[model samples]
Structure formats: structure tokens, C-alpha cells
Target: MDRETRLQALSAFLKAKRAKIPPESIGLAPGTRRRTPGLRREEVAQLAGVSTTWYTWLEQGRDIRVSRSVLDSIATALQLNIDERKYLYDLTLESGSGATLWKEESPEISPSLKKIMNELRYCPTIITDRRFFIVGWNEAASCVFLDFEQIPFEQRNMIRLLFARKELRRLAVNWEHFTRGYLAIFRAYYGQYVEDEWYDRFLEEMKRVHPDFDHLWQQSEVKTAPDVLIEFRHAKAGKMMFHLTSLQVQGSADLRCSIYTPDPDSPTENKLKKLMERK
Candidate 1:
């Protein structure tokens, strides 16, 4: 992105983050009925230990050099989480070094990783690209989830399936809760890779097709890929729960392997086994 465009994006991101924080959260008393939703510009400048005019200029998308220490102070003032702080850096920093680890091109899975995935007969494992495209999967994954081969290659994205396919949503128990976390991670990725035009196109398509997507996107939630538990109401096997674990491929920075292990507390194993046998 050009300097001016990047500044504009940074401006929007800062405004969004600022709007979420309440006065009471930062030990500031609600002195009066505020004109704006969040902590005022003066309040943030005071908290961040920067001049209000300078901060205002920064927020206004002015061409100003921001130092790391100043950015750190602003991050602290905003109470940014790890992912959000990183995103903040990616936006303000000129080098864009924060996003250096991510590659825009499609990732290639190694033979060894493919072999390992295939060996885990009981575990439903699938590999996804940076955009959560289902690039690879095992027989167990096909059995547990839908047969990926049946779907068009272009429609293999996890987000696409979750929002577009009603059957998948129906199968997932507590779909909103599961998808919220997914969306949070996706948002972080989108912010870091703001230069990617594909993200904008995909986002526009999603907003047009799915009504709930715009609402979720507007929340500005950021999250890292943490282990999560998901329960699926299978038509044939009945109730099945799995603990989802995501791992980054060693050599491929753009790929993530998700393995679904049956929850010990539930009868997911036997049900999965029986379901796999039928397949």
C-alpha cells in the first residue's frame, strides 16, 4: 500500500480501537455525558504521554514519523492485546517488518507432513492456507467433515463453508461461538496483510452474501490461533466432540494444520470410529 493509503487504514484502525474503550475501564471517571463513544482524544493523549495536537495529527492520517516507544505507549493506553498490538505496529511502522513472516502466495505442504497427516487414521486433520483454504486433508477429515473433493476447489475455504453452507452450520453445535474465534484470527490476518486486494474482494463478497459477517467484522476483535473445542452433531454418528489443535508448518509460514482429536469426556471416539468404518 502507498504511504497515504496506509496512513488512512492506520487512522481507521486507531479510531476503531479507541472507540471500544470506556472511560471507567482506564480509572477515568465518567465526568459528563461524552460527545464521542470512547475515551476522548485528550484523554488518550494524556494517557499515552504525547501532546494532544501531535496525537490528533497522527490520528488524522498526517505524515508524521512515529517512534517505537511512542507507539508502545499508545498501545498501552489503548489496552491492546498481543495480536492487536502487533497489528498496530504493522500499520504504523514504515518497514512493515511485523508482517514479514506471512507470504501472499499459496503455500506448499511437504511430503513428510502429508504422510504424518495420513497416518493419523482416527484424527480428522486438514491443512489450510493463510486464507483458510482447505489445501489438504486426510480420509478421517473427509469422514468427519464433508468430502472436500466433492466441493469445487474455489469454494474450499473454511470461512466460505461456514457462512455459505447451511448444512455445515446446522451440523456445528454453538456455531456462533466457534466462528467468532475464527473470525477474530481472520481479522488479525487481514489487518497484517492489508496490501492483499484479494482480502478486500473476498470480504465484500462475504458481506453481500452473509448478513451476520458485516456485524462480526465491525467488532474489530483480534485473536491468535489457540486450541479450541468444537462439537458436531453428525447426522449418522450423532453427538461428537473434538478438541481442535492448530499447528504452523515448520517451513511453510502460510500453512496451518488443524487436527481434531476426540474429546475424552465424550463418546466421540467410538462414534467417529463407527462412522469411519461405515465410510
Candidate 2:
């Protein structure tokens, strides 16, 4: 209801950004008279599919509730790039804007792909869409997820491991700094997908299930975990080094083929080999 700060910040950012642009740069006629310069407020509103009054209120730091859809449209109108778009989204959230983005996308990885995952049963694998929805999981993944199964599915977000689950938190060697960067990396990779219903539900469920995770989420820091230090507690091996690999699924922009490789000499490789032999 009261998102005045976001409106104000965005207004300032837009105003500052807009000032640098000349009307001629965008092919607009250099009107005979201009006050604030660079394509008037009316022009911006028209281009952004918003009413002039709405745009004015937004720039003036007034209380204006903006939906994610409208923000996307405005970002498009302003020609924001990936980082800029995310920053804009963050600004709104920082201002206490409460419209959570949670769009749902059905699992779409192929049955053939599932078979491929089965073929690599020795390797831990899972399929997640852009919004972090877990569509599929191989045996290795099942162990980790199963450990956390008591947590509600809607809130089974990966970020919770950093703050909520004490055991998992212990697994992360450099918890504090690692989390700071990982949060940003998460936003960079997943912020674009946050407007989905599934994502919103995921956050809500996480907040309900683990208040600690919710606290970290509120901090809004973003970063990615380092590749080398991440270790996993294996059900069979006790503990193992996992190398995460993500292969982009062509044609489907959101789908990623994620695989985990245990260290060659680590007990995991031997354990996996034994499983394959048993099969």
C-alpha cells in the first residue's frame, strides 16, 4: 500500500537517466520549448503505456503501487538491460512495494530427458526451470532433497540451506561471505523469473517453514557460491565433493540440464560405481 520509497528512487533514477538523453537521440522533434529537457513526461508515459498522472506520481515519490507486469513494461519502454531491470525490481522491493512476482510454469523437460537422467543415475542430477521449480531429480539429488522434505514443497527453495537448515549451513564452509555473493547471483539468474506465481509461492512457503531463510531473503544481497568449496553430505559415502554442471537446454530458454559430478578419487565415485554394479 505504501511504496513511496521505490517510487521516489525510481523517479530519481529515471529522471537522472532521462536527462542525459536528447529528444533528437530518440528521433523526437526538438520541440521549440522544453522545461526539464529530453522527451517530456507525457512522452515517457505514452511510450511506457502509463497515464501521465501515474508517471508524474511515480517520479514525485508518491505512494504508487506498481505491478510487476507494469514495471516490466516500463523497463522495456526505458530500454533497460538485464542488470538494470533487476536493479529496478530491487529498488521497488526495497521501497516496500508488496507485489510479489510468482508466475507458474509447468514442468516441460522431456520424458526422453528423464530417461537420460536415469541413464546417469550414478551422477546426481535434477531439472529445474528458470524460476527454480524442481521438475525432476535423480537418486543422488533425492537424498539431499529428502533430508529436507519435511519443509513444505512450496518453500523448498535452495537458498534456505544457507541460513535455515543448521546441518546444511554447516556444510557451507564459508557461510556468511558465500551467501552474500550467492544471493546476488541468484537474483541475477532468477530475478527475471520471480514474477511467476510459483516463485512467489516458493518464497511464501519458505517464510512459513523457515523464518531464518526468510530473514536472509529480506536482506536482498546477491552472490553465487564458489565452485571448489561446495561439499555435500552423502547418504552412502558420508560426505563428498560435488562439481555442479549446467548445460543449457536449447529451444527451451528456461530449462537447464544440471548434473553433479563427485570427485574422481572421493568415496562417492566408488559408491556410485557400486550402485551401478548392483543394478
Candidate 3:
């Protein structure tokens, strides 16, 4: 990512993170007539022991040199968790100019990876490129999610599926909750690939087409957690719940292997078996 774009992303991330902290959590009284959500910029500046104007400039995406110590202070002030703190560092800190970023080209899924996914007969598995485009999948994934085979390759993106596909929206029991987390992950990557125009175009198109997507995108929240619980309302199975776990491809950190395992407490396994039988 370029310096300017990285600054802008850092600005947005800090604002989002700042808004999540409650005043009372930091031993500050919740005074009446407070308008902004969570901690104010002045409050963060106070907590981080920096001038409010300088912090304000940071949030405004102005060009300024930021030290590791300052970043550490701000991170502590924001009460950032490990993943969030790493994200903060990634946005602000520069690797050497010789350091390589992930290539924009999609990573090729190896035959072994394909075999691994295909062998999981009961688990729904899919492989997504860095951009969250579906590159490979197993039979169970097609049965659980819609048949990706029928969709055009470019349109088979997870974000597109979530926002554009009514079928997925209908089946997802916790649509907003799921979409927020998914969007947050997407936003996290968006910051890392600031030079990619595809991200810009795709985001604009999504926000234009889907109001819900626009609303969520504007929030600027980010999450890097790989595990999520998803509940789906299947026509034949009634309700099915799955724990979705995402693993990084050993040789390809940018590629993600996501598996949907049936929740032990639910009838999801039996339902999936029955549903797969009809396939």
C-alpha cells in the first residue's frame, strides 16, 4: 500500500477502534449530553498522553511521522486486543522497501489441497483467494451453500454472495451479525491491499447496489478471528448450525481454507446427511 492510502486506512481504523470503548470502562463518568459513541478523540489523546491536535491530525490522515512508542501508547489507550493491535501496527508501521507483499495474482490451489477438501465428505469445505473469491470447493460445500458451479467465476465472491444473493440472505438465520463480521474481515484485507483498484471498484459497486452493505462498510470495524458460528435455515433440514473455521494454506498464507463442521448441540449433522443423501 502507498503511504497516503495507508494513512487513510490507519485513520479510519483508529476512529473505528476508538468508538468501541465506553467512557465508564476507563473510569470516566458518562456525563450527560455526550453525543459521540465511545471515547472521543480528546479522550484518546488524554489517555495516550499526546496532544489532541496531533492525534486529530492522525485521525484526519495527515502526513506525519509516527513512532513505534506512540503507536504502542495509542494501542494501549484504545484497549486493543492482540489481533486488533497487530492490525494497528500493520497499518502504521512500514516494512523495509525490499519486503514483499502478497502478489495481486491469485494463488493456485495445489492438487493436494483439493484432495484434502474433497476427502471431507461430510464437512462443507471451500477455498477462497485473498480477495474472498471462491476458487475451489467440495461437494458438501455446494450442497450446503448454493452450487458455486452455476455462478460465473468473478461473481462467486463471498461478499457478493452475502450481499447480492437473496438465497443466502434468506437462509442465514443471523444475517446482520454474520454480515458484519464478514464485512469486517473484508475491510481488514482492504487496508492491506490499498493499491488494488479492484477493491475500490468492488466496494463502490457493492455500496451502490446494497444499502445494507453501505451501512456496514461505513462502520469501518475490523476483525481477524478465523472461527465463527453460522446458523442456516434449510428448507429440508429445518435449522442447521455449523462452526466455520478458516485455516491458512501452508504455502499460501493469502489463501484460506474454510470448513463448516456441524455443531454438536444441534441436529445439523443428521440434517446435513439427509440433505446430502438427496444430492
Give the alpha carbon lDDT tens digit for every residue of 2-85 in model 1: 567668767877888899898999888876788878899888999999999999998899989899999999999989999889
The sequence of per-residue lDDT tens digits that candidate 3 reaches over residues 90-203 is 677753122245564556788889889988888999888768998899988888889999998878899889888888888889888878877777776775555565676787
Please, what is the whole-model Cα lDDT of each candidate in the order they appear?
A: 0.82, 0.60, 0.81
Please give, for residues 84-134, the per-residue lDDT of candidate 2 as tens digits: 577677666553222343234445668788899988866777665555545
Which window of ten consecutive residues has the lowest lDDT sum in model 2? 95-104
Q: Is candidate 2 or candidate 3 better by TM-score?
A: 3
Compute the lDDT of residue 136 as modeled in candidate 1: 92
- Per-prediction TM-score to the true structure, in the order listed: 0.86, 0.51, 0.91
Which regions of candidate 2 fall more than 4 Å away from where they truly are? 1-105, 143-186, 194-201, 218-229, 274-279
Error of 2 at 277 (Å): 6.8
Residue 45 error, candidate 1, Å:
2.2
